[model samples]
Target chain A: MDRQLVFELPNDLGCIEGAVEFVLLRCEFCEEVSRRLRFNFRVSLAEALANAMLYGNGGDPAKRVRVEVTVESSALQARITDQGSGFDPDRVPDPTAPEQLHRPCGRGIFLMRQLMDEVHYNDQGNAVTLVLRFQDTEALLREASA
Target chain B: MAFQVSREGDVLVVDVDGQLIVGNRQELKTRVLEELEKGEQKFLVDFSSTGYIDSSGLGVLVSLSKKIREQGGELRLSSLNEDLRTLFELTKLDSLFRIHDSREEGLQGF
Candidate 1:
């Protein structure tokens, strides 16, 4: 396991570009870990970052969001920590039910859960860690390269 | 995201591509509303090329539909992927907008 790459960004749209930059950088790092697994990591990372920028900060523009990416064993993990109080992960509305599909919020967390292998939040709810593990046995050989 | 606009008889079709997120919310809203305000209320937003979308993206769609309806016009979405369809279902937004499995169907519905 390598030392993690950490980035702290303001909870505002102005720092969004910077967050994306860090996301791409982490994607490149993940790619190097497994040349065969080019899993749309950048997209997933963006989803996570967006959640931190939006809900994690609780609309407090004065706060900041921190993202840490690391490669541990065979998994690539990106953890995002917000400066404000966190919400219950289970409280996030499920986007699969026919009754709740039109709302503007809650979709980012859904997408992140779908794209990543594992999504877990800290006890205090202020931090979340998303882990992506490259499936071995060549199952991702074609899809990863694509 | 990038959008392509074309006219199908009286209906205007807009093809949207790329991921729809908070970053492009304003831009997407402006472009789609601009077309709707131009008297092209019978519109179909083709999402065949759209790969992913978040809540902010969904907001743009909801707001656009509301804006068009206020002017006595309508907006429709077509060719949503499974992920996006699931998203629409989760947010309960599917009921608010007319969705078609294909662009041809969406056009014919208008």
Candidate 2:
């Protein structure tokens, strides 16, 4: 099965939950798949949206955020685009570093990457795409990847 | 977002009851900082009722922990679900913050 959802939102943190819930309620998955998807997708989405609103839009209420969700049999993808000048994701310091642990500002992108199977930032840096495959196949593909 | 603040022994326990995301993450900080302003220390945040949290929420916790520590106080977290625990571990904040399996355990030192 293939499903797609698109949500255009104001550059507001309050709107994030509606976008997440609307798309999640529409996804039909088994119990295991659902559990993993709920945890991984929800966290990644929230982080992405916060980045879009805070950094990309600079917390400007006039700007907007566009989110697209695509659910295919093998994988799921969410793209969040904001209306602002993009930034260099590489410039973001590692929050996990010993010295940076006390800094509270830079962990959003790192969490998105860790939770999602693939995290890609657009060349402009204003948009990010998060991908998660349905089956990590830890019970099967461990040998292959390793 | 609602926070249940109470005193148990000398520790101030806050029961956070909502998804701590970008929107309401500040409420937690404001309330805790207020308590800090009032000279209340030894805080334990119980998350048994919290359903979701993002990086912003994590940032608030880190900042609060630092603030409390600077004030000669402590911020302890308890009752995080498996996903949240993994989140803390992945960010390496599990090393920075003292986390307990339950509220009782979190209150042990305080």
Candidate 3:
């Protein structure tokens, strides 16, 4: 069975905690997700939520950030969208560059890409989808028995 | 998120608990800066209880690092679990800060 959750949050950073809590609570209901994978998903989702609230919505309290999450037996998917004008993710500087290492502007996108198995942006750049896949535990147990 | 600060001689040990994400990162920054203003030079952030951190949290740490250096102070980190350690590695921030396995080791460095 597949389960889904949707959240509509304001651009204010105050709502970030609630958003994270919601995702984590849903993860508890997903018995297929391992603890390690849940941790990874939580971190990635937090980054994405920050980006949506700060950059995508320009931190405007009036704007709304929409989040949709789906949990399956082997994967979890999250789509986050904002109301403001979008910017290109490609233009974000490499935070690891020698000259840029100390700069803090670009690490969010880098962490999102590194932590999630798949990351895709809409053509408008205001929305992003992150996916994480895990190995089937049942298959692993069967293989062990075989 | 909450922070508890204690002094071990000249070193100020900051114990941070909960997720260090965007909303509460400013609190961490403010607390550290306030301590820095009080003539404390050596600092250690103990993350043994920290479960998660986002880029904003990392940025706050970097900002604090630079601020401490400007004041001729040193900042060290200790007790990062596997996930946070991997985050530092992925961002290549592991090389920029001195990371220790225990609070005693971190305090020893400063």
Candidate 4:
């Protein structure tokens, strides 16, 4: 399956769920891959969008978030771009550190990296791409159909 | 996430349903903080019905756990499914909060 969906979300955090749901509906995969995709993609996308809105755009509802999702034969890629002066993602400290464990913020990027197969940021740091790879897609398709 | 609250002895038990993410995490934080302000001590967050939670949701939980501890209260989590459990484990937050396999287990010594 090769399909792409592009949409824009306002910098409102409330829009994350709706946008994720929209992408999930358009994704096509075998049963097992679909199940994992739902959970992984939902969490990863929500984290990515939150980072874009809260940090990249500084929670400015006036800014727009551009989302472009592509479903490949064996993976799904989502790119989220925001309008703001980006911060260095490398500077984000690990949330699990003993000192930072109690801190309420700074976990979104960490969670994205954990859930997505690949996480990338543009040089400007205003945009991010999260990729999820399917496991044994050919075998899973046969199993699903049988 | 939507919640059902009840009192199990001195512990305030909250049953969360639906997804917990950035949008409504503050609501959960506010509700618990309100309870903390009212002098309620022990707390249990039951997530059997919760399907998913993003980083923001987990962050709120961490913040609440800290605040409750400062109030000399306790916080426990119960009934996280496999996916949620992995999230906690992956983030190494499983060590930060007291998690029980069942609500009964959580409420036993609370």
- TM-scores for chain A over all candidates: 0.80, 0.89, 0.85, 0.87
- lDDT of candidate 3 over A1-146, digit per residue (tens): 23888869878887877777778776775655555455667777878888888888888888999999888767788999999789899988889998988976579888878877789999999999988876654465558779
After the best TM-score superposition of candidate 3, give how far the Cα of residue A85 lies from its true spot, in angstroms: 0.7
* Model 3: lDDT of residue B44: 97
lDDT of 4 by residue, B2-108 (tens): 87889999999998899777788888889989999999999999999999988888988999999999999999999999999988998888999999999999999
Q: Assess each model's interface with DockQ, reporting 2 decimals per model.
A: 0.42, 0.89, 0.74, 0.79
Expressed as tens digits, the lDDT of each residue in B71-100 for candidate 3 is 999999999998889989999999889999
Off by over 4 Å in 4: A30-32, A135-146
- Give the root-mean-square deviation of each candidate in angstroms: 4.6, 2.5, 2.7, 2.8
Candidate 2 per-residue lDDT over residues B1-110, each given as its tens digit: 47889999989999989788788878999999999999998999999998887888899999999999999999999999998899999999999989999999999867
Stretches of candidate 1 exceeding 4 Å from the true structure: A1-3, A29-40, A136-146, B1-6, B17-19, B34-39, B47-52, B62-74, B78-109
| Candidate 3 positional error at A26, Å | 1.9
Give residue B62's lDDT in candidate 2 (0 to 100).
Answer: 94
State model 3's lDDT. 0.85
**Residue B29 miss distance in model 4 (angstroms):** 1.5
Scanning candidate 3 chain A in windows of ten residues, the lowest lDDT window is A29-38
lDDT of each: 0.73, 0.87, 0.85, 0.87
Q: List model 1 lDDT by residue over A95-144, tens digit each.
A: 65655554445566776676677888898888888887755414566566
- In candidate 3, how many Å is residue B58 off? 0.6
Candidate 2 lDDT score at position A133: 85
Give a tens-digit lDDT track for model 2, residues A63-113: 999999888777889999999999999999999998999998799899888
With a 3 Å backbone cut-off (N, CA, C), the pairs that clash in candidate 3 are none
